[model samples]
Target chain A: MCRPLCWTYASGVLAVLAARTDDTNPLSGLVVADRPEPDVPEGWRLVRVKAAALNHHDLWSLRGVGLRSDELPRILGMDAAGVDEDGNPVVVHAVIADPDAGRGDEVNDPRRSLLSERYDGTFAEHLVVPARNLLPKPDALDDVEAACLPTAWLTAYRMLLRSGARPGDTILVQGAGGGVSTAAIVLAGAMGFRVWVATRDAERGRRAANLGADAVFDRGERLPERVDAVLDSVGAATWGHSLRAVRPGGTVVVCGATSGDPSPVELNRIFYQQIRIVGVTMGSRDELAGLLAFCAARNIRPVIDRVLPLHQAIEGFAALEAGDVFGKIVFTIP
Target chain B: MCRPLCWTYASGVLAVLAARTDDTNPLSGLVVADRPEPDVPEGWRLVRVKAAALNHHDLWSLRGVGLRSDELPRILGMDAAGVDEDGNPVVVHAVIADPDAGRGDEVNDPRRSLLSERYDGTFAEHLVVPARNLLPKPDALDDVEAACLPTAWLTAYRMLLRSGARPGDTILVQGAGGGVSTAAIVLAGAMGFRVWVATRDAERGRRAANLGADAVFDRGERLPERVDAVLDSVGAATWGHSLRAVRPGGTVVVCGATSGDPSPVELNRIFYQQIRIVGVTMGSRDELAGLLAFCAARNIRPVIDRVLPLHQAIEGFAALEAGDVFGKIVFTIP
Candidate 1:
């Protein structure tokens, strides 16, 4: 899956840029440009990009959160798989945190930042990352599939494994068709959880069944039985239903709030029912490794909505921004 | 602590009753009465309650939330230390659940209810509870302190232990002077957590320091450092502060919503900083047993603000209603 770095970057390097922010028109800031190669910091390795996946985080960055106009001309992609300088096939761990600070889990570090937040991201032909962030890419998953795992899949993985969920329990994934929701459906099903999904779109709810969800409900549709946990990423749009879906003493795990803040924290319901609300980030390297093994063992392939050549990546971003993409959109560098 | 069952209820049992519900004036519902003794049902034991403690739950019952006009004349205390029919000193675990349903944890049982919710409670000369609800009281804590444990102190205990708080962590107890807050300060300190407190009253802040809080801050005052967890019972008044006080990956353990529900669940902070909000109700029988042993072993007696005779319980309830009481208020039966 390794692509020659210099072929695409004839003069310098080709990268997708969120050059500035316009909250009303986030895509207006995006620029495809040829730029100087990023200087590798000490203890960091330069990887020749093979493939990368898009995330809603990129959209958030373009909206001036996590990425700012001051940090202009920033490349935007957190999940990537490529060949390191040493020629080892590897996946880049996007989070930059002192491992010691997080007690061996980088995601828990207070000062943690993801790729493109403070550093150049994987949209380029070559990218620099902490050497320690490299994980041996599994043989089972191709570069594009491996690229999708670091951000969305890893987040969903943590929501299941680290969010205190046990096997043989039913879990409600808040959205039916987003990257994390689709990943969670497959991962949770493979891991023996009875997966249920909620969606406002009837079509998406039906499509969710093909992704291995045991049951699908219309958004806010009351269920006959309470679930043991809920994996929520679609914030304000689904928080109340997420809280209501779980059983007494069950957990509601949150990784993202795409729809913004929810109304009424529902303190009364929380304490009365003894619900546990856990906030999850991307994941730990150890968990990423476990996810890799888990996926390989179960033959769990992440759902890919579409694939595009790196030069056509802007279309992928536009499709994602329009919410037209169901699963992940991966860009393969020529 | 072994009181004779027939002594107090010689004719009819003396009890405090929520005779009716008045939202505007909650205390108007409370009445001193000589009511018929509750017959011990199958798998239940009759207890001659030697000491009973008050909680805001009693106030809520009178406010027509937990109790209704149909369940009028219901005894209202959830905490009691008494002598069972076998004459063994015991404390009542107020939660009523079918042990089989919760997988050995009664608090997790969906059908679980507190004593006063659907049955006669411990504010009487005699009360009946399931046999499993009795835990032999340790001699170290007398009837008054032991009675305080099953509801407030055990709630604090569970909030600390079951809420994912670790030892050697700093826990901020919101509100310096409530029964649960004071209990949290004492228990968290004895359990090796650095205890911080937030309160508006200067006198209560000083009093909290005396209760083993390592530091005290005015309510909503910005702290120099984030805490590992926050014990929140103050609800809306301190919800934002509690969310702000905990570090990323830290917890806000909620057991009550006295002030009201927090508006706009801070979903951005919850997901962005990865904050956990764990809800804790009164603990399980096993946890109550551990709390009993822990308090006895540590010589940690609950702070009682005042003790009133059963006949003068109205005055005690008034002090609680006014929020003038700093610690637990217990009623001793003659």
Candidate 2:
């Protein structure tokens, strides 16, 4: 699964760049072209990308959410697996933050950013990241499988850990087709939790069952029993149901709001029921390491929607933008 | 100030009862009249009330929110200090639910009801409660002060304990004059937290500062700095401000929503900033015990607005309903 550190092709390499941003049509900015090899700063290492995965974050970047215009032509991708400069197989921890600034919790760093948001990213033959951001890739997971672990999968993994649900407790994952929801279903099942999914699409609901959801309900359907926690990425659309689905003293772990923000924040139900709503973003570097180890130890493999070569990265981004990806979309670099 | 358990008053006793309910004029339901002395059920003990405290919950009960029309003519107090049949000075823990039902946390019990909801309450000459619901009242706190703790003060104590803010960290308490808010300010300061208050009235804001608030700001004013957490009971009125006042990864602990339920639950800000909203209600019996010990050890006294004889309980309820009270309004039983 490891690729050589690309010492021969140092000048130019195939990469996907957010050449320009369009708020409505994020994929219009996706360009699959050649990029100059990145410069490794002090304490940074270059890794030759073996496989990179697409994320909603990539679409958001092209829509100018976190990526600024001045930082345009930025390479796109937050997750990857490859070989580091020292020829060690590694998986990239996408968050670039000063741990000291956040008092050792990188996610709390105000200036924390993902790979492509601040630097050239993993959707290339080669990319550079802080040396500390590399975790040893377990041999059990192939490059494409390991590549899917950093962004959506890592977010889901951390959400579950922080969800306050015990292994035997039940958790409701809202939405089924998104990358984070799919990953949460599989990981939560493997982690010994009873996974229940709520999705509008019946087909996706069935797939969720195959992916390890113990029960599947129509989106907004009243659950037969309240869950111990709810993992929610579809915000406003499912927020009410999420709140209603959790038992008293249960938690709602949120990573993203893809459907839009819910309003009339029901403070009454929250205070009366003693519900805990915990917000989570991408996980920490240590958490990512733990995720990789957990996946390897459990013999868990990420559900890849499709795999494409780096030159065909635009199609991957297009599929993700169209909400057509059921799981992860990976781009392998030859 | 322990009242003797009057064995002579076996037939009738003076009590403030909600004879009826009024949504607009809750005071219309108030009746200070004679009621038969409560019969102690199995495992229940009689506590001759010395002093009882008023809470907003009393107002809600009068308005028939939790008190049903069928359950009307119920007693109206939740906080009390008195002498048990064994002549020990004790503070009542108002929550009455089967410990087994809530798994030892009465607040989480689905059928949990306060003292006045299902049984006789403290605003009377004598009341009956489960024997386990009494704690030895600290001699350092007089009956009126101890009476205040079992309701608003205990609620505030629990909220701060569960707030996730460290001793040196700052907490923003929304509203300054209410029982919970006033208690939060005083207790938070005594617990080593820097207490910041938000209030609509300048006089009340000044009063809050006098009661241990480190700073006070106009309601909805932008804070100069984000706090580690926000204690919000103001609900819809301060919900948005509460969200914005907290630092990233900070918390907002909500106990009630007096102003109204905030609309637009702001799922975006909640998940994006990684804000945590923890809902808390009244403390458990253990927590009430802890509050007593903390107060006794720290020489903290609950703020009392005014004390009236139980015969004149209507005035106290009126003051609370009018929001003319700054802290607790206690009614002493003769």
Candidate 3:
């Protein structure tokens, strides 16, 4: 449908783009195409991306949740690990915001935007970002594993830190096998928390146990004992259960609402039981740096579901949209 | 309906009691009658009540919200100041709970009950409580003012302490003239916070100003700027406003839902903005002590609307039910 000029590597670089959009079928708009290499603005650096990971954000972008119709052909990715022009390996911190605007915590910035929302993203063989966006990737992790740390893993790490649960405390993670939830299970175990997973899928529960959850429960099942905090990404489907699963004066830390928001939230139960509901998004740049150091120090490796060549990014998106991934899906750039 | 035998001072003490329940007309069950003076159990001390304060809890008790039918004729009061057996002037810590059960914070105990809920309360000539429940009343405060601190003032103090807002930061107190809200206005100012009040009544707004509120807004009005935290006890009527009034990463501290619980809680807004919703009941014994010391040191006085003889307790309940109060209503014992 295009002149060959659009695909010529001499003038463009290979990348995945959300060329169009479909609310019901997000994959329809996904395109494996070519895009001009990003320019390095002043105070920015160009990175040759060695690997990238797919996330729910990509599918949501295709469905126009955060992307606009006019922004079609935008590169589609948020997590990447690569070599900078100076040859240092780095992982990009996806959030783009002025640290001062958020009073030193960039996540609180009102004008904050993710990589793919307002600018070219990391899906391409070459990408440009403000120089401050890069954190040194630990030598212990390969490109694929480092690529998994920026978005989901960083979010999961921050959730646990915000949960206010000390070591030896118990936490209930609602929803299993999702990127953030799975990361929380593994990271919480490493952080010395007693991790409990609740999922409707028995297979996913088993997989979560394999990743080090101390206990697993059927979704909405009453816990054997109340936890000190709960991490809920399942939202409407698991909100009530999360509320009831925590002890009085306990906390429920929420990061996402994948199942939709619950109606008629039980404010009575929230106040009567003296519960706390804390929300988190992706962590700050300093937190991401801390995550990388912690993982390297602890010898933690990200769970990779599968890796595909960059040209096969469409298959990766399909698997993610179909809810078929148990861990991160990586695209290795050739 | 009682014989003269029930009225003898030697046989019984004069008290306000909930003899029955009527949900729609709560005042119907309120009875000014005679009840036997409480017997001191082991480890319990009896106090001759000099003053007691009225709260919405008294009305709710009359409606049988906490008092069961089998517990009818229950004495109804939670806040009291009086002379203990040792002739020491003391204030009762209304929360009757074992510190061991809640890891030293009695408010977190599942079996915790307020004075009027599980035991005969202070709207009588004498009351009994665990010996540990007494704290010395500051000589600077009279019996009436000390009586106002335990139930509502302590709750407001704890709510502000838990709000996570630092001194010089702004806080919005929703529903301005209720006991907790009024106490928050006065205490927040003394605690060095910029207190903004939201109220439906303009008169209450002006009165809040006289009590040290830095600013006032009509209920649900858009704030000039988002606050660092919001104190919300209005619940359904003000929940949405409370959510919107705070900045991202800010807190909304809740203690009661006097206007009924909000429906369709905005979980999406909560998570997306990284807001924190904290629920609080009454404070702990230690926190109550801290509140007393702070109020004394800061020269903070509870705003008293009126002081009436204990025999006029029914009139006080009627005023509370009719929403005709600006501050605390204290009943002095004969």
lDDT of each: 0.88, 0.88, 0.89
TM-score to native of every candidate shown? 0.95, 0.94, 0.95
**What tens digits encode model 2's per-residue C-alpha lDDT throughout B1-334?**
1111222234689888888888988888788777886788999899999999999988889888888898878888999999999899999999997777664577888788888888778899999999989999999999989999998998899999889889999999999999999999999999899999999999999999899899999999999988999999999999989999998789999999889889877777787678899999898999999999999999999998999999888888888877898999999987
Worst 10 residues of 3 chain A by lDDT: A1-10
Residue B93 error, candidate 2, Å: 0.4
lDDT of candidate 1 over B108-213, digit per residue (tens): 8999999999998889889999999999999999999999999999999999996556778789999977899999999999999999999999999999999888
DockQ value of candidate 1: 0.72
> What's the TM-score of chain A alone for every prediction?
0.95, 0.95, 0.96
Give candidate 3 regions above 4 Å deviation: A1-10, A20-22, B1-10
* Strongest candidate by TM-score: 1
Error of 3 at A221 (Å): 0.9
Clashing pairs in 3: A264-B264
Off by over 4 Å in 2: A1-11, B1-11
lDDT of 2 by residue, A189-300 (tens): 9999999999999999999999889999999998888889999999889988998998888899998888777886887788878899999988889999899989999999
lDDT tens digits, residue span B21-96, model 3: 8898888787787787688999999999999999988888988788899988788999999999989999999999
Candidate no. 1 TM-score: 0.95
Q: Residue by residue across A1-334, what tens digits does model 1's lDDT show?
A: 1112222345688888787887877887777778787889999999999999999999889889877667887888999999999899999999988988865667778899899998989998999999888999999999999999999999999889855667899999988778999999999999889999998988888889988888899889999899999999988889889888889888999988878888888988899898999888888888888888888888889899998987777788788888887899999997
Best by lDDT: 3
